[model samples]
Target chain A: MQIPSPYDMIAIGGSAGSLPVLAELLEQLPVSIDCTMMIIVHRLKNVPSDLDRLLSLKAPITEPEDKQPVLSRRIYLAPQNYHLLIETDGTFALDYSEPLHYSRPSIDVSFASVAAAYGPRALGILLSGASKDGAAGMQQIIAAGGTGIVQDPASALFDTMPLAALELCPEAQPMSITDMVHFLTELKMSAEHDQ
Target chain B: MIKEISNEELETLVSLIHRQYGYDFSDYARSSLKRRFQRFMGYAYIGGVNELSDRLLQDATFFERMAQFITVNVTEMFRDPLFYKTLKDLVLPRLATYPTIKIWHAGCATGEEVFSMIILLQEAGLLERCRIYATDLNAVSLLKAEKALIPLKCMKDYTQNYLQAGGMEDFSSYYTADDEHAVIHSALRRNIVFFQHNLVTDQVFNEFQLICCRNVFIYFNRQLQDRVLRLFYDSLAPLGYLALGLKESMMFSEESIRFEAVSAVHKIFRRKS
Candidate 1:
């Protein structure tokens, strides 16, 4: 049997200076992106956050419960203090495991699990962060034949994370926040056109 | 390498755990449980659910370790210091009117919060009248709690948390630190009782003036959370305090009506008379 088009999931990971860029990116994203999108950012455990409400203005975002189905064409933000994983059946898995790289909602955990669940159909994006947490997971995504993208270090407020990602996936295309939004918009248009 | 566990495989393991050990994990959130099992599998180098089941059946020692792994939770001393401050400023004062106080720290992994509570009681001069029951499903963690030794590395952070929680005295005074570890002062350990108590399979043995079961219910499904909340409610004395993790609340359960929020932002609730 022939496999379907490999563009089922888009996962974005960031930390430190992600909010403004994320807002800009979300603002530019069209309603008909044609795939499931998930965002993971480092957050302090036990602290209440208003991220879901803030992001919901752009697109209806769900802070999915454990075992909830990960549906297509929707945006999901990982709940604070929970390591979000993508199950093989395309559902969300929440883990309260010890913090990885001092982060409970570690970008690494989400990226690796996304790669495992969606394989070549996934696209992993790494943005600004002060740590090298997501580098290995980004590499895993690339190794699994999924596309890996990173914000250009020069444009990122905290360059360590993007630089680390670049070190792991040397061939990954780097884009500024504006360029990333433009590139994704083009990708979505072409994907819709293909249908 | 860890492989994805199929639905059938997951059901088999959950049933096996229930049948063989009488531990009820069936009601726990399925995705979280699967992730935890997968984590254990990765650590133990067990390839698949069948092999995990086989190893668990053959080796009792492995089962003991597995049980520890299942119940182990990541915790920090004086986590969300403001919550501790609320306990000190509001909760503890109300409990002080009682002739004697009984506090239960349910699922007290590694006993950090238990120690934090003891410190609060001690500083308030209420430690002598307080009887603390600290329990968890993991016996290994209970023993570690009994030891009351924290890594020296974490002491600084814990101290900062202590200060943020409004410590009147120097935070370092509560522990004796060497190069590698900080052992809580022996005096603070006097009123504490650590034991193995599985919330899923255990019954309430004592009425408590205050029950702190933070960060435990997030792992459970709604049904399990409701069940546990009811258990907590029954175990609490009239007008007693029930403290939950920041993310957890009784609002989602039928039990919410029976309790009033002492400080909703801090997740402190009191049983209504």
Candidate 2:
């Protein structure tokens, strides 16, 4: 199998049953990882206030800076009432102006931006979530020559987002959290080998 | 049967648009172009696509009305505030290093975004060093942009956006409110030059440190998007920044590989080596 290079950034989007899967994935990944990780989890505007704290249990979590430079190995979570975007200089931004897809922290907004900026260097991972938010974005990632991976719908806690992504891009890899971690580890190792 | 619009009808409509209007819908996504044109025909009280095509050839007034329907002119002041804020905080620092800056607001409809950038550059103390080229495909929209005014009711909402995007001073200070209109301050308008430039048929005119074309390309097909992205790529200085709408992506475009993500969440990219 031809493994893609180590990604500059990994953007994951999920909602509903994603908390456990995200926790599991973070726990398995090491802090020494070279890439930046960004996650957007859909929650009631008020309820997920402690998302930074929750994700920080496994990885260092920070609220994205408006136009701040992108830092590697840190996990950035989308703040409430803001859409997170990746800028060209490897920084993060938060927009609180309006909501797309009726959600402030829209999956499509973040994923599409990643596909645009990172192109083939982007890795998009879609997990269990409600609705079809990330479907169109995943297609964009694939079309941009980025690698796309989704949690298996059958294995997902909430199958909607994963299933929607699968429907949109049939060739996307569907893996369990353990397998996904292994895949990323191998990807990193292969990248180092090539270098 | 309802979907069966004859080839002759399609050909006639395409020819009418090219000849009479001098606007080309020939290369637009077929299904979406057809749907929009059909709706335009119905709204204008014309009899179907073929008749609408013929009427366009004869009546200049109908063509003017048709242009409005065909153009996607939706825009907002500081529509993506965080992106503007990023330009202020991150990109402006780099732009400040230069003695002069040229910024382009491509596809600037009605000038809300152009004025928004003007306000941002002013706040950053870069306005005096900057010259903004605000261009759009629709001449009607360009005229509106040149007016530099917005509805008074929208001021409250835009003010809120300005604050959230980290406005250091009062939003009211930037505009003068009279009756139902807010005239943008003359200081902010000094460096802005408004013109009509189509991304599809136009060539790059100047190199820019920052180019903002937000919420516009989502209406375009992939081919057009690629064409516009190339135009932007050619227009940007090396290591210059490109900011797009939240939903717009440079993926599938030739320029995608030539830029790096500065901020993934803000949809900001910088030209690469």
Candidate 3:
């Protein structure tokens, strides 16, 4: 067995039309992929969020409970109106402070925190969104020497987010939804091979 | 995936926090607690959980910093404006009937909510009769709360929230601002006491007519949530009110039977006689 890659935390942030892309991406991944995934999507507060349930159809997913330990192969969604952060120990930290850019679960807050917690071990992906919220966070991830990925603006339903991210991380690999799925599978396979 | 903090290391750290500091975080949501421990380790520049434990043993200042981290301290004035609006429209009228009003702001970080409550009571003509005990486990936050100064950058956002929450006067009237910070008017600070109190370790100090414990319980595990809810239940006067964060609820708690929702939409409840 090949040694497992240190990159295990996959932090994804998106809004607007990112759901379909997420659904598709998860559907393509093998169920036994040895990584922990966390997704932060703009969501409505007070009303119970069903994003976790909706996405779990494609993969095992849950809204992380306060301080819950992050589990491999399980997908975690930022709870409605909470910013999802990672502690250095790789457990989930949900923050209920004022919404950033009028968004709870602000992509910047989560991305920056994850970069700080995981540094080079983090893999951050920016997806479609109407706003430029995730750009600075993507910069933080790349600055920390973590890999940064962006959805190709041409393929995004809303290109504003990806364009903004590209401005900060010119080196960020832009992938189409289908290509992104293949990339994730290859990365997983490589990690497994190393183990 | 990265290996999680070993259970034995986690237990030793929590035990140290409990034994040395007397703050019982053992019942806090374990996953969140572990996450916080990890963040604390990173912040302290330690490489491992065991190293963090050793540092805690060697350094007293680390405990003080840990107190700040262990209790999450993000808050804003009039958060969830609709909840405040609900209080103004439906709850304040009932509070006005009392000759003297006492409120407890559990986990009152940096005191923004405390000031927001004062503003509402002042506008309702109830400020003169109201006394609020705002408490938190973090002394540094309590000190900041006592100072009544917040970054002026947030005032714009807070102003909008104040208006949406149904402010009767100009929001600017509540504070004086300079280039970097805004200091709440001294008038609103009257009858408000900022103190260090631990929800997990402290006993009920007073029976309150209103308890505004918002957004704090979501950080706790279910067991701790139940224990804290029961404490609030025991500390409330008959027919008193309890205002929770819009996302928090007592429905799943053992004390749920003791109170009825004042406005279920806003998570406000009134103790049933």
- Which fraction of the native contacts appears in each prediction? 0.30, 0.00, 0.19
The candidate 3 chain B region of ten consecutive residues with least summed lDDT is B1-10
What are the TM values for chain B, all candidates? 0.97, 0.91, 0.96
- What ranking emerges by lDDT with the best candidate at the front? 1, 3, 2
**Candidate 3 lDDT over residue span B191-254, tens digit each:** 9998988888789999999999988987776678888988998999999999987656575567
Candidate 1 ranges with C-alpha deviation above 4 Å: A1-10, A16-20, A27-38, A43-94, A112-123, A135-148, A153-174, A184-195
Per-residue lDDT of B1-273 in model 1, one digit per residue for the tens?
Answer: 256676688899989988887888888766567767887999888888889999988888998888778665678899888899999999888988999999999999999999999999998989999999999988788888888889899887888888888889988888898888899998889989999888887898899999999888777776787888889889999999999876565665787898999998789999888
Q: What is the TM-score of chain A alone in each candidate?
A: 0.94, 0.90, 0.93
Residue lDDT tens for model 2, A2-52: 333468788889987999999988877645557778888776542225778
**Runs with alpha carbons beyond 4 Å of true place in candidate 3:** A1-12, A15-39, A43-80, A84-94, A97-126, A129-154, A157-175, A178-195, B1-4
Better of 1 and 2 by lDDT: 1
User: What is the C-alpha interface RMSD of model 1?
Assistant: 4.1
Better of 2 and 3 by lDDT: 3
Interface RMSD of each: 4.1, 11.8, 6.4
